[model samples]
Structures are given as structure tokens and as C-alpha cells.
Target: MSPNGIISISILALQLWHCAADLCNWTGSGFGADGDSRTVLQVRLRCTEGSVRWVYPGQALRVVLEPNLSYAQRTTVCIKPSRTFRGASVYIERAGELELLMTDGGRPEQVFCFRADGPQRPAIYLQASPQSDVSRPMVGFRYELLGNRSAAPNLGHSGLQTSCRPCNDTELLMAICNSDFVVRGYIKNVSHDPERQSSLVEVSGGRVYWQRSGVFEQEEGTVGASRSVSSWHGHIHTLLQCHVKPGGGEFLFTGSEHFGEAWLGCAPRYKDFLSVYQTARAARRNSCDFPLD
Candidate 1:
């Protein structure tokens, strides 16, 4: 289940200064430093529609700066989102792009909590951008990963876990993660004509669901009409539990292409198998544009 709202840490709201016309970077000299001087340490991060993007050589994230500090060796200031999406935090970059870092970490996830602290696991250190801080004899520190600062009570995570790699063919990626909170995924593709070819997202114990082709509107429970969503604002249909269940859940896609669609049926969860229904609703509608982020 998703929370109604989320909170942001003060550091998560760092002051940002403009850099190049096409870019903005964080440059703060704490404690000591001169305009002519520099530091050998820095934290790297970026905001986007999905997870924060770190402009690494390959556009990847994660790296250790060799800092000697124990706790919070350092931290990154986060800029809260201007709005919300799919019941998650919304972040804005200096470029005006939006993003959110949703992770299953401890209730009070410090960016490192995964699976909501349900279990201990490897650290998912995220980096946006790092700078050299010669003023301090330090390498750098690791900041938190994506997600709300205050994890939901049931926010389950076991730290960083892996799944079957999408080696070019990911048609099966959707079917696999449709069963539990543990079975979640990230989107690598977006934009499929906009009018059609919506993206998909599969979660543990949930099927690959999609967006309803409209903006952020509260959907009707199952057995209702086909909901409308904003195309540009992009509604994130959490088929994870919308159409299938009739047990007081919103999200049902009653259209032609889905009349008799069949799939690998599994034992259902939720009193009326809420998860299964939503997954199927998303699967059949062709409206599940969930992989954008």
C-alpha cells in the first residue's frame, strides 16, 4: 500500500546555485575554505523524473570517496518535490526536472535503509556529483539513496537485492515481480508514442500494471469505468492492486483488448486477491505507463 504523503529531511533540501546554462551544481564550503581554495571531497547527486541521476562517466550512481568519518561522514541537501506522484515524494533538480527516490528502507530511512529495514543488506550508496575539498583531509562521504525520509510503518526492505537481469529481453520481467513488495523494479524506458504503447512496472506479488492515460485523479474501485489520467503529467496506475480485487480497491480496466486475456495465475493475496486484480487491470488496459522513472 502507498502512503498519502511523505516528508523531507533538512539536508535533503540543500541550497543549489546555478552553474552552466544546461546544468546546476551544489558548491558549499562549510567550516573553512577560500574562493581561491578548494576541497578534495564532495557529494554527487541530481534530480529527475525517476531516481536522481548522477552524471558519472557512464551515467551510473554509487561510489566511495575514501572519507574517514564514521556516521554521516557527510550528507547531501535534498530539494523537496513541488508535488507528489503515485503516493511518493517528488524532487526537483536545478534544471526544473522532477524525480523521487523511493526505496524500501527503515521507516526513517536515511537513504541507506532498504526494504524499509526489514532486513540488513548491502548499502545502496547514491551519488549525484562530488567535488574536491582540499580544505579538509577527507576523501568523501556516502549519502542516502531514494525514497521518503519517513518510511511508512509497513515500508518493507531488506537492503539492496538483485533480480533477474533484463538482458535485452524483458518481456518476462513484468510477469515475475507480480507477487510481493519484495518484487519491485525500476523503469529504463519511457515514451512509446504517448497515445499508445504505455510503459509497464511489475512488483513482488503484483503484475505489470500501467497508467490510466491521464493526470493525478483518484481512481474508482474495481467494477467502475475506465479512469482517465494526464498524458504529460502521466498517471502511474499501481495495478499492483487496483482492478483485480473488488474488496474496496480502486482501479479496474474493463475494455475490449482485455475481454479474455489469460496469464500465469498464482495464488492470490488480499482478502479478495486485491493484488492480482490490479495487476491484471494494468496488464490488459495498455495504460500502465509505470516505467518512466
Candidate 2:
């Protein structure tokens, strides 16, 4: 075989090696000859959540998400770029066409989400920008795949707009029953992050009925006369557009957890929730039995 033929065969073997490895977290470097700059490395990740890092990126990389999902259900994919992410642009490939998802110079704190429904399985493509120095920039992002049962409604765009609209009676009832955590709390503080376009709501939970994840924990310190020693404290994340405010009244906080972070869902004032719950209960329309304090 010619020397050039042998070099081509070697590159083909390297590409195949990367494609065959199913990993949850992938870290690789793209540094090679001029011909290798045109090579597109393929990576397959089968996990529901993971991260990908490309160091000194030169050639393009294609990431295929093949999480185990039910055919009858829909799936949502969300990616959060690392704060230090640089030197690459991300695109979603559907039907052999590319749709730009994140620009190389875009806000790193911002998250992007899209629906991965339909017959065509979506894949992420990372195209590296031209380099001028030997700075060795790293491009990376974390990803999560949410199924229909776990995904919040309308988790498109930034995935933070799910709580923009107030939930209706039926949705409210269902949220308390299906959410990861149900708490009776008051907003202690509300902080907005413009960079991420999100709001962080600090909650002082008086009562935690149930919590799938240990997101809310008991506060340590002297308890006030009106406060319970068993009171839990936690933060709930929501989009800044929701404009969450710290009010005086207690509320029934119900929400789901994503990637270990608690997200706000349907929250109604305690009194209003009681009125709704009682009315639904009397009419035999409540989704599930919720203990009242």
C-alpha cells in the first residue's frame, strides 16, 4: 500500500474508534495535519445525562444522543454550556440539515433546549471556529434528556419558560401529585440573574409533604417562635420573565427537579390553594389526596 493510503487508513481507524465508544462523558482533542482538519469525529452517548469537552478543537465533532426512550413518548434535550466554553458553535442536525443552536461567542451561561420528537433522531454538531494562537481553547457543554413523563410543559427555547404561565385548576392539582417536591413555603428572597435569564427564589418551607430528591433541607440555627424547627430551606429556579416576587403570604410550592436543580412549577397562595383543593375535593375532582396543615 502507498504511504498516503496507509495514513488515510490510520485516520479511518481513529474515527471508527471514537464512534464505537458509547460514553456518558467525552473529552478529546483535535490536533492533527491539514487533511485531518476536515475530518469529522463522531461520538455516541447512550446515557440520559452527560458532558462533552473538546480541547484545542480543530476538526468538527458530531455527538449522537441515543438515550433509551419509549417510542410512544416525546423527549426534550437541553444543553448548558460551561462558563469557560469557547471556540466552537453548536448546531442541531435534523434531516441532514443544520440548525444553529449556540454561537461560539454566545452567552455561556444561557441554556438551550429543543424537542427530539419524530422519526428522525436529532444529533448535536460542534464546529470549531478558526484559531490564531496556541491558547488551546476548550469547548464543552452538559446535556440532559427528559422524557414526556418527566419533562415540564413547553420546555422549548431555554427550557426556563415552563413556569411563565400560571397553572390552571387541573394542572395545579396534578402538579402537586406528580411534582418531585411539595412544600408549604414563603418566598424569603428573589434574585434575578440576567446573564442566565433566570430567577432564583429562596423559599422557607414550613412543611415539606414529600420530596423525591433531597433538595430542601432543614435549616440549622435558633428557630423563631412562629417558625418550626423542622422547617426546610431551598431555592427554586424559574425564568426571569416570570418575575417571581417575595411576598408575605405562604404558598403551596410544587415543582420538579432537573439535573439536581429544583425548578418552580405551580405555586398558589396557601389560602387560594386550600379553596381550590377543597372545591375539587367536594366535587370529587381532586387528582390526589393532599394533607392540609
lDDT per model vs. reference: 0.24, 0.77
Write down the lDDT that model 1 would get: 0.24
Error of 2 at 185 (Å): 0.9
RMSD of each: 18.2, 6.8
- The residue-by-residue lDDT of candidate 2 on 218-286, one tens digit each, is 875556666545568998898888888888999988887776788888898889999999999999999
Which tens-of-lDDT digit does each residue in 91-127 have in candidate 1? 2222222223443121231221222122222122222
Best by TM-score: 2
TM-score of each: 0.20, 0.85
Minimum summed lDDT over a 10-residue window in model 1 is located at 254-263
